[model samples]
Target: MTYEDIRVEHRGGVSTIVLSRPPVNAVTPRLLMEVLSALDDLEERGETRCVVLAGSGTKAFCAGADLKADNTLAAGDSFRDLGRAVVDRLEAFPKPVISAMRGWCVGGGFAIGLACDVRLASTTTRIRTGDAYLGVIPSWGMSLTRLTHFVGRNRALDLLILGEDLDAEAALQMGLVTRVIPEEDYDAELARIAERVAGGAPITFKAIKETIRAQYMYTPAAAQALETHWSDIGGASADMREGIAAFREKRQPVFRGC
Candidate 1:
């Protein structure tokens, strides 16, 4: 499908989805839909083992909702519904997803990052859930839930209630981002990490993601059951045997999603 709000690029096993709505890549229903479409396309492609999300230009990864745009904040429920869909889909995506953020990442924008499996920030990045200060709450999917899960209740409360922006270092400390890279190294580091993640065994990666999400969604025993299920799937996969063979041969394993 043709996408106007986002650009999808494939490099080796990794697919990078760049938010194309410029000047901040603020969220809109169209943009959100485009993102969902890109994800659908990537997930079906066996070559796309990893996905990276980034924004256009140098301004911001995303500046949250385009307050000035129609069918956005003014449209109310429609915006909320789409926001929820995009973030929820990201959180549960079958393939690994990474958010490469720079400059401003606020409210729904930051929520998107939180939903990803990993978040990478540049030194210039500043993230916050600014709705509280506006006399509103985060209505974008599971923002608060993910935030609290990453940063503890106290830190989550501090960010939400105060509507303060956390710099890259602070975000890393709070576990909001996997790593903070210098502005100059941001792109290179993100590419390196994406390549590394993309090269990993797909079945193992999917199993790990599924198990981690299961822990939060199910009872302890149920979660364990899901883990065991995935364990069986992974253990019986050809990739597992290939991994073992590679280990014996002292060579890098080539994973074929099967």
Candidate 2:
């Protein structure tokens, strides 16, 4: 499918969605709709094992939504609900989603990265929760505990409430970003990460995501029990047998996500 605001490129097991609107890549209704559609499409493609979310150009991942957009503001009360819904879907998507961020990751952009399972940034990356400056709260419910779980409560508050523009080093230290690569190596490093993730056992990755989600959905006791359930799923798969065989043969295992 074609998308005006973004472009999808599938290479082997990895499908990458790049926000294509340049000069800031500000989010708009079109971008939101297309992104959700892309996610839905990739979710149904069993051959796709992982997704890479990014933005075009070196200036920004997305500078947030276009404030003047008809659907964006109403006495600080509204913006169509589609954006939030898409973000929520991204958060709970069964497959792993990785965000490769550079330049400005502000407001909604920051939230988008938070939704991803893994975040990697270039040294030039500057992230801010730009909503506080607009006198509006994060529409995706900033209090959803994602940021807190990534960073501590106080640090999350510093970004959400204080609206500090965090540089790559600080973000990494806070655990908001998984890695910060040098600008010159960003492209190559991102590809390597994607290759590694896409080559992993699909069923194992799915189980890992579920176990993490279960951590938030269940009590500590319940989550512990849930761990066994996910493990059993992995243990029962054909891929598990293949993994053992490959290990004994000293060869790479080809997982079918079964």
Candidate 3:
């Protein structure tokens, strides 16, 4: 499907979704809706093994929400619903999603990157979540949850409440991003990482992704829901069986994502 504000390209089992709004790829409601739709398509296709999300230009992965468009909406459930729809779909995407960030990643843009399974940023990237400065709380709760778990609560609070921008190195130190590369090598590095991820066993990747997310998002009590899930599903998975068989046979295991 054609998208007005984004570009979707598929190659080598990796689907790259580019935020295409110029200057700074701000997340307008329409753009977010399109992203949700695109993710749905990718998941349903099952052919896509991985996804990379990036912006159209070098200046910014995204600056934030389109304040001009957002301001036009009345303050009520409609606004909340819009934001939740976008974030919820992103959080629920079945496949591994990577965010390749460059330049300014702020507010909603930062939230989107945080939602991804992995984030890689150029050395020049500046990351910030500035909802507090706008006299509002962050609507994307899971990102903060992840941040707090990855970093300490104090540092997460400092970044959120102080609205401090972190450079790529600082972001890595804070566990907000996985890697930072030079701007000159950013595209090549992103491509290599995406290719590696796409070539991995799909079922194993999905299981690992789900396990990490479950651990990151749940408390001891809440984790109970997943206890039976892994046993029932993972114990019977083809990849698990192949892994054991391969170990005995002293051969590489082939997985079909069953």
Candidate 4:
């Protein structure tokens, strides 16, 4: 599909979604919509088992939302609706989603990274939750919840209140990211991780993802319901059959997202 603000590429079972608005890669409503659309397409295709969300340049994964370009701000419901839609799409994505951070991931940019299941960053990457500095607070639902869950209440509060950027290593130490590798090895490392995830049992991975997300965001009853649903799907899936067959044959499994 044609995209104005992002690029989507699929290689094997790994799909990389790259934010393309150069330099800072600040998101606008249009860009956010495009990203949501791309993710929707990927889910519908059912072939992509892992996704890496990154930016086009070495300078930024994404700087933040472009307040100047966000025309929906004064449009009330549209603005909130768009933000919620993007967050919801990311949260519900069936596969493992990774955010590859290179430079500045700030404000709304940080929100996107937080929405992903895993975040991997270059050692020089910086993260900022800059909402307070802009005279607003973060309104993205699950992103803030996930951030607080990962970094704990104190660090999350410090990030939001102070609006200071945390370097990649510090972010990893604070539990904001899964790994921080040197910039020179960032791309290779991310590709390696993505491929590893893609090669895993697709149905089992989806089940695990659902369970973790439920625990992260839902009440016990709700989490249980989600767990049951995902368990049923995973138990009956063709991917499960493939996994078993491959195991018995001592070969790699070929999953068709079934």
Report every candidate's CA lDDT.
0.86, 0.83, 0.80, 0.82
lDDT string for model 1 (98-171, tens) is 99888899888888988899999899999988796777668775556766766778988888887887899998
Model 1 residue 61 CA deviation in Å: 0.4
What are the per-residue Cα lDDT tens digits for candidate 2 across 1-258? 878999999998899999998888888877888999999999999878889999998889888887776755542333447667767777778888999888999887888877788999999999888576787666675434567776777887777777778899998998888999999999999989998899888877777776677776567677677678878888899999999999999999898888
**Sliding window of 10 residues with minimal summed lDDT for model 3:** 70-79
TM-score of each: 0.97, 0.93, 0.87, 0.91
Instruction: Compare the candidates by lDDT and give the number of the best one.
Output: 1
**Cα distance off (Å), candidate 1, residue 17:** 0.7
Q: Number of backbone collisions per candidate, in order?
A: 0, 0, 0, 0
Give the alpha carbon lDDT tens digit for every residue of 12-125 in model 4.
889999999988998777888899899889887767889889999899999877766646465456655676777677767888899988899987788888778888989879
> Candidate 2 has which clashing residue pairs, if any?
none
Candidate 4's displacement at residue 227, Å, is 2.9
RMSD of 1: 1.2
Candidate 3: tens digits of C-alpha lDDT, residues 133-191: 88866776644555687678898888988888889999988888899999999988899
Give the candidates in order of TM-score, highest first.
1, 2, 4, 3
Per-residue lDDT value at 38 in model 2: 93
Superposed Cα deviation of residue 134, candidate 1 (Å): 1.7
- Where is model 1 poorest over a 10-residue stretch in terms of lDDT? 141-150
**Candidate 4 least-lDDT 10 residues:** 70-79
